[model samples]
Target: MPPEHNAGAEHMLVSMLRPLVERGHDVQVWLSRYGKAHRAYEYRGIQVVPLQARLDFGTAARRADVLLSHLECVPSTAALARGYGKPLVVVCHNTHRPSLRDVAAGQTALAVYNSLWMEREAELFFAEYPKAIRPAESLIVRPPVFAGEYATRPGKAVTLINCNREKGGRVLEQLARRMPDAQFLAVKGAYGEQILPALPNVEIVEHVDGAEMRERVYARTRVLLMPSSYESWGRAGVEALASGIPVVAHPTPGLTESLADGGIFVDRNDIDGYEAVLRRLLGSAAEYRLVSKRAKARSAELDPAAELAAWCDAIEQL
Candidate 1:
């Protein structure tokens, strides 16, 4: 686990593992590179272990029946699993350049994709490779959000989780200038700095832990904005929906799936269209109420227990 904090992948990992722990299944998280040394504590009954060196990988791998890995750790973990004769489960959290070496190695028993779009993307990326080189099994497991963790409040501002260019900082700047009457809250992210000029209406909030999202961000959010050019799955949109807040985002495949009827999808380049949609929602109480209801309804679709069961079933079969 490279990302120590403020990562959706890490948050989703914790959510999936917590239920397994409650069910009395021994679950442990081993961080390949430790950043938050002082913060290494048991989380929801699972011990967080930090590996000191590459040599420590074998010790940890030997203890686990199935090795689960994500992102940068996949290649090394895949190699280790091959050596240990353990089932390697690779979780695809985002769309990236598929490594031919890793996929062709035949070590991965399963590939767990976060979205159908991501799964399809992976299939396309590996289309040129021989069929035998691909992972034996592939499945879609949408990210889960605990609806009970969020609540509907009397919020009046439009919220954006991350303020980097990749997360649409330029769009935020344009929107802020175009819609001066609208209030926007931009939460800083780990990847990029805020380069947008200061605007009176847009308020920049410091990043908060995943546990504090409801209280710190969603509490004052009327609508969520996800103007990213690309996304495998938009976690912030679902988080907003859990709070009964509608999302206005670019019509990316992942966003379309996650937000569903709860979102008003506008084109990324259509600034005027974005403004028009926002105006309708903000200006009309009835429309906002309807969208809010839909948002909550959409949020209900993401059942953490169901997702955990799916993961458990996959692990059991593995």
Candidate 2:
């Protein structure tokens, strides 16, 4: 099932669905109450089902041939498959184990870490669990971005991204004050709106469709500013790179893996270091050009269709 407010999962679901439908496989989406009908309604030749029942596995399983669960929380579907002799495939979006507190209380176990970084984190957290109760068929399949419009000549526009409370809005406020000439566009909510008073350069935008978001934000963005406290895949970083733009991110756990070699990573606490890197990149056209080229190259390296095919192969093997 899809999360209520996650664009990353929406992109992944659509990416997987398109290919599966083309290959003559039936596709269905089990979504939460909050999930938008726009995507499910917009798809061509696919069955989109909204699930209203809470953990009604027997009911959901009987409607479909194979079940592809989006997150570990939906392992109830896996349990259903076990009971009904149906095939179950679970997708891992992040690698961080639920906090120790959650595990100690005997919560769900299956998960998919989007990067090698997250997979390692998960393995360490589940060290105490017996091999049998732990994630048995989890694998990393980094999220993909659909390539859309991008700036032919990126100007001084720098994107400041943070959707939730933990996304380091304070750091961005400081940067906005220092870099008065730079423009900022962020995914806005009540949590992010509070920062706008301190950040005049930043524009708060409503969550938009991925393709539209790419054209409006990613296309013109010269650098994607990722000061995230915790990011599983750095969706903004990957999207910016796919748009031929470089990223400047804090060296947070999941952000580091997503921006590796594709962009710059500054120590999270080193405010001075972050500023210096941004200034250096902006000042040097040659360095910016090189990094920009590499960013786009890296984005193209992860093919969504290819990744989904690989995931399908793994599921088939099981």
Best by lDDT: 1
lDDT of 2 by residue, 146-230 (tens): 6553334465676665455466666666776788877766655323443553466877766555545666676567777777777
- Candidate 2: stretches off by over 4 Å: 1-6, 35-40, 44-46, 51-58, 99-112, 131-136, 148-155, 189-194, 316-318
lDDT of model 1 at position 259: 87
Tell me how candidate 1 scores on lDDT.
0.80
lDDT score, candidate 1, position 182:
92
Q: Could you give me the TM-score of model 2 versus the true structure?
A: 0.80
Clashing pairs in 1: none
lDDT of 1 by residue, 216-245 (tens): 899999888898898878888888888789
Model 1 scores worst on lDDT over the 10 consecutive residues at 96-105
Considering summed lDDT, which 10 consecutive residues are worst modelled in model 2? 100-109
